[model samples]
Each structure stands twice: as structure tokens, then as C-alpha cells.
Target: MSTVPVRTGARRVLDGLTRPAVAAVTVTVAIGLWQALTVLTGVPSILLPAPTEVAAALRGNRADIARHLAYTGYEIGLGWLTGVGVGIAFAGLMAASRRLRLAVYPLLVSIRIVPLVAIAPLLIVAFGATLYTRVLMAAILTFFPVTVATLDGLLSVPSSQLDLLRSVEASTWTQIRHVRLPNALPSIFAGVKIATPLAVEGVLLAEFLAASQGLGHAVLQAAANLDTPLLFAEVALIVGVGLALFGLVAGYERQRRWSDGTDGLGGFGTRGGGAPAPTPERALFGAVALAALGGSWVAGTVVVPNAAVFLPSPSAVAASLWETPDLFLTAAVGSLHKLAVGWALGALVGGTVGAVVAFAPRTRPVAGPFLVGARVTPTIVAAPLLLVWLGISFSAATVLIALATFFPIAVATASGLTTLPETHRSLLDSVDTPRRARLFVRLRYGVPTVLAGVKLSIVSGLSGVVIAEWFVANGGLGVLVNQGMRNLQPTLTYAAIACLFALGMVLFGGTTLLQRRLDW
Candidate 1:
């Protein structure tokens, strides 16, 4: 049994106001306020364009915007389709075999550490600034979340379901198809919905990085030309497309939820009902997979002509690190310090936002669209602008890291808090629980989801910190990376990249351990 105190009177009143008209009014009021603030403050249009200015710019460049938008949309569509297929397939394969999951999971973690935007230079060097490159980035970025969601979904089936299937002597594939897949599809669809915007984000980022065609190019040109109105317009266009896609996904999700034939038999998997038991051999396989990756890296350096210049030998990278161990260590320590502060701030703010979203229903209609927009906004491109505005300061960097981390934590927190069992919800509704008691109770139940969000935020926060360091040109690993790349020093570059990867792994491991401890 559970209880949550609801201040029933005002909440009931507010519920009546959460209609479509109210949302429209809220947004209108917000835009009006923005316009008034800009006009009264006399802020330079270059720094902060009024909404009307953005509208004018949009009107002026409608044709170009439409064409480039179409190009980007095509790339996004292709990438999202391929990524969805691959991610779902990969999750299925992993669910079907423990050994393969052990072998592949480490590689996935390692690959995830490398920010999608950061890999643009390497990709451009290897594959050129082509449409294929753009699509690849979109696909890769979209792949991860889908894979994770699908895997969790597949493992969520009830033990009773598994036992019954086994008693019936069901074939493994048949059991998987009939029971797990049906149960998982809803979860899978949720993943696909969340991933659609990410695909758009990836394509925009690829364009920004490689100066490829589409809205991304428009952003760069606007920024370079000091066309702030156009820049805002481009950003708006990008965000608009992402939101549209999100709306489509949401509609599909609604349809699926209503039509879900497996609703009675399927549920979101929190417990690993039929999952493989943990064993020492799983760790050994992960280690072997890592070793294989290293061997592949070494082989690439050996097999490819002129690869030595770009990829560098592992020995050479090792020697570079060996020679500059102190430098790397100090840089790592400094970066970690900044990352800690930013992550803490992000955790606080994002967690609060998520809690509000989950616990308070009346405020959702007003807040929901903004949250989704923020989720899809290509904040990677905003880093440089942040640097420009805030300058090379620690506070600025910390803020950037916070901005990066908060959204994931908030999303995760809401997910965790909202997933209370029906029994719990019913109990809460039937009793007048104290507010403090309710919050603490929910917090306890929400630990896993909140922790999951915190874990996701670390990678995002690291990316933010790295971008800050890259622009600040301070004594951090990102500085070393930038220096090495600009100078074409492969050994230095590889060494910095290696250190960054190591740092990511440490943070990831720490979070996993913490989550496990809390779960226990």
C-alpha cells in the first residue's frame, strides 16, 4: 500500500484549465513576453532577435529553407529507418544469446563514449563530406537509445510467461516471437519515438560539422555572416521538423497503445524474468572483446597506407602517453572537477523538473512541449555561441555541462516516478498521505529510473565539458585533442582520445555500481 497527499482543491481547478486553448494562450503569452522584453530592453537583434524578426527571416528565405529542409529531412528519414531496424535487430540478437551480449556490450559502451559530433572530423577525413556521412551520423546517434530500450523491453516478460512457454516445449525463436516480441513492441515503439528527434539532431550536427548542405549549412552561414535572424530561423526550422516528427511518433504510440493486443500479457520489463544469470565468464568475454578491438585498431594502422598519419600506431600512442603522463593526469583531474560541479547542478535542476512533470498533472500541458523541444534542440551547435557569450570562464563551462546533463536526468526521473504500480497508485489515492511522506516514498521507488537518468547524464555532461574545454583552450584533455588535431599530431590525438575514453568508462562504471547498490 502507498499514499501521496494531494492538495486536491486547487489541483481540481487547474485540471479544468489544461485544455488546448489554455496551451495556446500560454505559448502566446510567452512569445508576447519575449517580444516585449526584447523591445523594451533594446537588445541588439544580432544577440537576441525578436520573434517577428525571425518570422520575417523565415518568410524571406522560404524557398531555400524548404529545399534545404527537404534535403535534411530525407537524410533524417533514411538514417532513422536504418537505425531503428539495426537497433531492434541487435537487441533481439543480444536477447537471444548471452555470450554475444557480453562480447558486444563493452564495444557499445566504448563507442557511446565518443560523442557523435566529435567523430565528425574523423569521418570527414575517412569518408568525405557526403550525404552518406550525414546519414551515417544520424543512424548511429539514433541507434543507441533504441537498442537500450528494446533490450530492456525484451527482458521484461513475466517469469510465469516464460515458464508456461517452456512447459509447452516452445522453440526458443517461437517463444521469443510469440511472447517477448509482442511484449516488447510497445516499449520498442517508445524507443523509436524518442529516437526520431535524435535522428534529426544528428543530421543537423553532421551538417554543422562537415559544412554539408541543408539547414545546418544555413546555420553556419547565418552565424558567420552575423545574420542572427536567419540563424534563429534555421534553428526554428530544425526544431519544427523535429517536433513534427515527434508528434507523428506520439500519434502512432497512442494508436499502438489503444490497439495493443498484448496489453494483458505484456508489460514494461523492470525485472529480468528470463535473463541470463550473471557469471564471471561474462566479464572475461567483455575483456576479450576489448582486446579484439585493440587488435583491430593495430591491424588498421598496419594494413592501410598513410593510415599511420591519421590513426597512428598503438605503440606510438602509448609512448606519447608514457612521456606525458603527468600532463594527462592533471588535465583529467581538472576536467573531472568541472564535470562534478556541473553534473551536480544538472542533477538537482533536471531532477526537480522531472519530478514536477511526473507528480503534477495540471502543469504538464504548458510544460510538455517546451521539454520536448529542448530534448530535440541540437545543443551541440550552441556550445560555441555559449563560449562567445560567456567567454572562457569556469562558470560558463559548468553551466554548459549542467545544460547537457539536466534533460536526461529529468526525463529519467519522470519515467521513474510515474511508473508506480496500479496498486500503489490506488492506495495513494485512497489515503491522505503527508506531502513529505509522499515525496520520500516516491523517491525510494524511483531510485532505479533516477539513477538510470543520472548515468545517461554523465556521458552527456562529459560531452558538454569537453566542448567547453575545447573552446576554452585551457589545460584539459580536450585542449590536447584540439592541439593534436590542428597540428596533425596523430600520436598526441590518439593519446588524448584514449584518456577521454578511459575517463568515460570510469564514470560509467561508477554509475553502474551505484545503481546496483541502490537496487540492492
Candidate 2:
């Protein structure tokens, strides 16, 4: 009996290795094929470098990569810490006060939609492109997801638990420390890990805006010099770092799984962190927050010399908009078209694939890299290869947007799909529903989860649209933003930024309407 049990245990261990082995083999074969095709076709390395060429470039440019990486590493490390600290503290404050939550959450969500790079100029004006500016940009980029996730987790603690604490007459502080904080850990980790790659992209965006010593600057420099191999190598390093950070957080979450009972990454405690439907009270508070922000902007001009140049007055920005009303209108239309197309494509694929994957969750391990790559392949990294293949076309830009939006939707969809209500599951089983029917039959139940993903996607999609215009397209609000930045025209940049903000509000407002319509 003992011998038989040992043999079965050994077999189980071997079985567990199969998917990893296959994944390794698949990657090796893909690389082998890539090398062979490039070598046989004699394609120019500038267009599509072979793996060996990229590897050689990596080795050759070790010193340069190291130098740039040091700056980026510093930005990411400090930014991530700051983001976590602020995000959690702010969530604590909001949890402690309903009025604070009502005031701040809506304003923050609206601000989060601006392409993170666009803020670099404002920061540069205030802080002079120093380490503080770069770190702050990254922290701001990372703040929303963490705060939303933590806030939701804290607020959504089970009624049973709250009642139990109340029955014992536990102090609010004691209850929060023992119950809310502990249960919120899973969601907290979920947001932190998800934001890790965003932090990397954030630092890169800051580098793009104004920096000489970082991977983003290095990419632009290499592209300017037409050094394709080095560009690919640098991009690979970025993707690797993002994946490594994700793996680190995910591994820890797994180890702590025994104690985690609340929804993992899927539910995010509540639908991904949009503010609750507005009441008159919420509207007044949100308006107060916006008014305060606007007041601060006005106040800054009085303090800074030459504020008109660096921080254009609202009237100047508004005048800029009026001056080129037609230009902005045209650009907004084109940008919206591309945004819609890419979002639709990503949503379709993500929801479908997520559903299929929900039926076979064992696939997640092997599928992990591709899913992570979808997010980590920032616009800066994709610029060269996409331009090479698509030749500055709409398709390339759409793909870039899709890459930004797909991961969140897919993750959320898969999570939601797994949670079919018990009654619904049994009903379907009793009728022997087909797999295809089953996959979508309960989609209504997952609408909240999927809607959460869609909201997140809209934010990321806006960022993609900005970068797409910067690199691929010739006309868009993004082009205006880039041109304004390059020309040292703050009013023009701010005007373009205002258009982007308006565009974002439109998209988000539409989503809100759709959510209300569904009301699932």
C-alpha cells in the first residue's frame, strides 16, 4: 500500500509539471522559428531583428542600458512606495468619513483619465524635471487603482462581521484593525500588483516628457539613430521587469491564500472603483473639490514668476481653444473613432476569451505571459515594431490602444464568469445547458464585474490614444499636445489637454449611462 501511494504521488508531481514544460517548449520553438525565418529571409535587422541580434545588442549595450535603468529603477521604487502609502492612507480617510469619499473619489477618477505624460510639463514647470517630478508622476499614475481597491474592500466588509463586532461592543478602531484591514489585504495586493506595470509605464512616460537618463529616453534616442536591435533589447528588459514585479506580488498573494476569503482580484470587493451614483449632496461635494482645485491653479500663478508662460491662465487656454475650434473638433472626431474601434475590439476578444478561459482556469499559468504582455507592452516599446509593420497607419494605432485595454477586461471577465450564482448554475445543469450557452447564459450575472473592467479600460484607452497620435498618427488631440509641448506653448498644450479631458468625460459619462441602463 505504501509503495503504491509513493508511485501515485510521484506521478502527480510529474503531471503538475506538464503545462510549464509545454509553455517552455512553445516559447523555445517560437524563438527558434523567429531566428530561422529572419536568417533565411535575409530581412533587414532594422525592420525586424532576429533573437540573436537582439541578444547581441543587449550584451553590447549593457553599459548604456544599465545607466538608463538606474534612473528608471529609482523612479519606480520611490514612486511605488509613495503611491502605496498615499493610496492606503487616503482610503483610510475616506473610510472614516462618508463626506470625504463623496468629495474626492469622483474628482480623482476624472483626473486619472488624462494621459499621464501630459502632466509632465505641469510638473516640470513646478518641480523642474527633477527626481521628485518623475517619482510624483509615477505615484499619481498608481494612486487611483490602489485607492479604489482598498476603499472598496474596506467599505464592503460583510454585514455579519460588522454585526459580530458590534454585538461585542468593539470600538470602531478595533473592528477596523481586526476585521476590515485584514479582509482588505487581498484587494490591496490585487491593486498593487496590477498597478506595478502601470508604475513602470508611468516612469517611462515621465522620461518621455523630459529626461535624458532612462529607458524611455533611450528608446527615443535609439529610434532617432535607427538602432533597431538596441531598441528591441531595451523594450524586452522593460517587459521583463514588469512581469517580474507582477510575479513577485502574485506569489505572495498565493502564499497568503489560506486566510483570504473575500473576493480576490476578480470582484475587487466592489465594481472597479467608480463613485456611487450621484445624489445632490455628492454633486455639491464633488463641485467643491473641483472648485478648490481650480482655485489652487489660479493661486499658483500669483506665486510663480512668468506664470503666464509656464502656467497659462484659464482665459488664455480658453482663448487658444476658441482660436482653433475647427482644428480641435476635427482632431476629436478622429481620435474618438480610433478609440471606439480599439475599445470594441479589445472588449469583444477579452470577454470571449475570458469566458472560455473561465472554463479552463488551468490555462492561466501558460497564458500568463501573453496576458501580462498585453499591458506591459507600452506605446513607447511598441512604436518601432508597429511602425515597421503597419507603416504609420490607423491599424497600428488601434492595436496599441487594444493592447492597453485588453488585460483588465479579460481578467475581470474571467473572474466574473467563474462566479455564476449557485441557483443559476443548478438551473443550467438541470436543463443540461450546452457549454456555449452556459458560457454566456449567465453573462448577465457578471455584468457588474465586466462593467468594472470596461471602466478601467476607458482610462487606459485614453492614454493609448494620446501615445498613438504622438507616434503613429498625424492628426489628433495627442498630436496637438505633443506639438504644444515641443514648441514650449503652454496655452496650446493646456488647450489640447482640456479637449482630452472633455473627451474623457464624454466617454466616462456614456459608460455611466450604459451602466444605469443595464442596472444588473
Candidate 3:
């Protein structure tokens, strides 16, 4: 009936508002609680200012926040754009040239192992702590993921598709634009999504290290003057900008999906941008993988024997897994333990907050500020304050790591739950499903996104743990890397970095396999 269509449209509108309505209500309640707790705890404003006080400071200092925001945004925007462009181009080149991949892959892998923070100081010195320095820092932070994601995506395209294009004798440019580019779109977006936050954080880190005007510099200045309210305001503003940018990117991704009849992942068309058509050369990848391993082994053994330095042979690294094994074992175990604890803490906190918001629409308004606080804050900037409060210990490091890791998973979970298909919800409703049953059903439907969030959280938490160690830990790879760099031991520094990358690959690869196993 005409009335039914009208009701359906209205319901869709209401459903669209459901999650946000809940988020808004939650935010309001949270703010009220925060204010009451601050008063009850008698926490110094310097340590934990009331929400009202922070709001007042922000209202009064709009111009200052604006000025710093503009400066920092310029760096984030420029670096992100440049990084994506270069990453796409390089990734394409890698896909097109096996020789180039063979020649440079090892070096690329090695460079990726070095923590950007460790290299940041040297970049600042080289670039003289200017806007250029900040841009370079952000770009460096952004490039790897974009490159790796795009390369993986492009190569993942079905070979049959390429053969069809070749059968038609597509021009090189045509092939790239019509085939590879479309195919890589999802990977590129994945990279962009990952890079967006990192570039913003990197800009802040650079500004904190050295800048005349920017949110990062302002926060440091406020800290130096012991202006807690002002510091919190600036921090809040910076984080708000980051959240805004992140949302912008997500929106773009969604739009692309809609336009392409895909989801967040685009480029799965037949000839244009569709699911990679069957590749004729599927077996090539297996051969390439074997060849790469063989080359790496030979390089480690024969190549190292003739090289100038005592290059840790592949055998040495493998043997180190047992010999001076403590170095490898201790480092691996220490990092893994931190990663596990951080991931678990993040999952629990983020899941609880998200579930509460999903169920309690009225609390969204109260949670607004806290969500922003979580999203915008770079864990690095907060490390100093965390040090003061939690002290330079594992607790502080773990908390910082947890904070970095939690929000994405929470946001993703909330989004997935809220966006479940109407038919599925209606079917459950028709059955008069219990509330607990509904929750489980929703969780099952949302597992893919939840898993993605988990993977992201793990990697981000690992990065946070490393950064925290640089400032706060007595041990761990980060500490070792920091000490090695301080003592001018490039090899040791590289070794620690190598270990970090190995850890990342293991964790990331492991999660991927688990995801596949779980069909997430």
C-alpha cells in the first residue's frame, strides 16, 4: 500500500538516526559523569580538568586553536596526498616489473623495519625542523602502508583479466588505468585509511619535536607554562581535526563503494573495475614466492660471506632463534605479551563502550567528548603526561597502547551492528528473538568488521608499545633501539628494528591466517 511505502521510508530515516542518536545521548551522560568524578576525586585541574573548564578554555581560545590547526593540517594534507600518489605509482611499477621488485624489495623491507620515530630526529636535523620536515615526516609515515597495500592489491588481480586485456592488446597506460588502477583501488583505500591517521599523528609528532606554530607546538608550549586547561583544549581541538579528516576519508570510501556497487573495497569489475577476473597465470605467484625465498637464502649465505661487514646471515637470524636465542626470544616474548595485553584491553573497553552506546541511545551526547579525545590524541603526545601519572612502567605503556588500539575496533563494531540488513533484523524480530540472542546474532554478522578492527588494533598497539618504550621502558626492543641509536650502533639499532618488523609480519600474518580460518 502507499501508506506502507511512506512508513518504510520514515522507518529508514529513523533507523539511520538510531546509532548516532545513541552516540549523542551517551556522550552527554559521559560528560556529566566526568564532571562529577573530577569533583569527587578532587583531581587537580592541572591533572584532570573538568569538562566545563576545558570547554570554556576552548571557547575562549578559538583563534589559537584555529591558527595551529591550519598549520598542522597543511602538513597532514600535503604529506598524505604526496604519499598516496607516490605509493600508487611505486606500487604500479612494482607490479609491472619483476626485476625492479627483485632488486629493491629487500631494501624496502629493511627500511620498513626502522621505526619512523627513531628516524624522525635525523630527518628533523636534515630538514632543519621546518614545514618541510613535518611534511617529510608525515609522508614517510604514510608511504609504506600505501605502497605495500597497493602492491598487494594490484598483484592480487586475477591473471585471466590481464590476459584478456593483453589479448585485446591494451596499451600500457590503458592497461594500468583500465585494469591495474581499478583493481588496486581497494588496497589503495585501505592504505589511505591507515595512512590518514598516521600522517596526522606524524605531523603532530614533528610539530612537537620542532615547530613554531601548530597544535603540537602549542600543546608543548602550554605544558611548559603549566596551563592545563589550555593544553587540554588544544589537545581536544587537534584530535577533533583528526577525527574529522578520518570521517571524511571514510565517507569518500563509502561513496566509492556505492558508485562501484562494491562496499568499502572498489575495483572488482571485469574489464573496468570488478572482482579480479580469473588470472591465467595463477601459478606464477607460487613460482615467484619460491624464487624470492631462494634468492633471499642465497643472499644471506653466499652474499654475506663475501660482503664487507659481519652481515647477520639468514642462517644467523634463524639460528639466533636458538643460540643467543634470548635476544630473539626475550624480545619476541616481551613484544608479544605487550601486544596481547593491549589488544585484550582495547577489545574489552571499546566493546563495552560500543555495546552500551548501541543499546542506550540516550547516552551518545555524553560520550561525544571522550570519543573525540580518543580519536584525535596521538599516543606519543600523551606519553609524557602518562609518564607523570602512571610512571615510566609497563602499566603506562600498556594503557597508552590500549588507548591507541581500542577506538577503531569500537567504531567499526558499532557501525557494523547498526548497519545490519533490514530483512535480517525483521526476520529476527518476527521470531521474537530474545535480547541476548539478538546481541549474539548481531555480533556474528559483524565479525568481519570486528576482525578487521582487531587486526588494526594489534598493529597500532604494537607501534604504540614501541613508542612508549622509547620514552618509558627499561627494556624491550624499543629501549634497545633507542639505546643503540644513542650509542651510535647502527647495526644494533638495525637489528632491533629488524626484530620489530619481524614481529609485525608475524603478528599481522598470523591474524590474517586466523581471519581466513574463521572466514572473517
TM-score of each: 0.85, 0.87, 0.71
Residue lDDT tens for model 3, 1-520? 7799999996676566755575665667777999999999999998889998999888888888888888888888998888888977887887677656544444454345445665554455444778988888888888876777676677666788889989988876677777877877766776676667778888887776678999888887877777788887887677677778767876897787823222222211111221123343324544575577667755765654433133335544455444555775686578677767877888899888877776777545556456655765577777656655576788877887888787877766665566567999999999999999998878777776666566666667877877777665557777766555456443455466668777876776676577667553
In candidate 1, what are the lDDT values of residues 154-182, reduced to their tens digit?
87787799899899899878878988888
Selected candidate, larger TM-score, 1 vs 3: 1
Backbone N/Cα/C clashes per model: 1, 0, 34
Clashing pairs in 2: none
What's the C-alpha lDDT at position 464 in model 1?
75
Where is model 2 poorest over a 10-residue stretch in terms of lDDT?
258-267
Q: Which candidate should be chosen as best, given TM-score against the real structure?
A: 2
Instruction: Check candidate 1 and list the clashing pairs.
Output: 156-269
**Candidate 2 lDDT over residue span 100-208, tens digit each:** 8888877766676666666766677657777888899889877877887778767767789989999999987777788888877877886786578778877887787
Off by over 4 Å in 2: 1-15, 18-26, 163-172, 258-278, 348-352, 359-363, 434-440, 446-448
- The best-first sequence of candidates by TM-score reads 2, 1, 3
Model 2, position 341: C-alpha lDDT score: 91
| Model 2 TM-score, all chains together | 0.87
lDDT accuracy of residue 258 in candidate 1: 35
RMSD of every candidate to native, in Å, equals 5.2, 4.4, 7.0
Which of the two, 1 or 2, has more lDDT? 2
TM-score of model number 3: 0.71
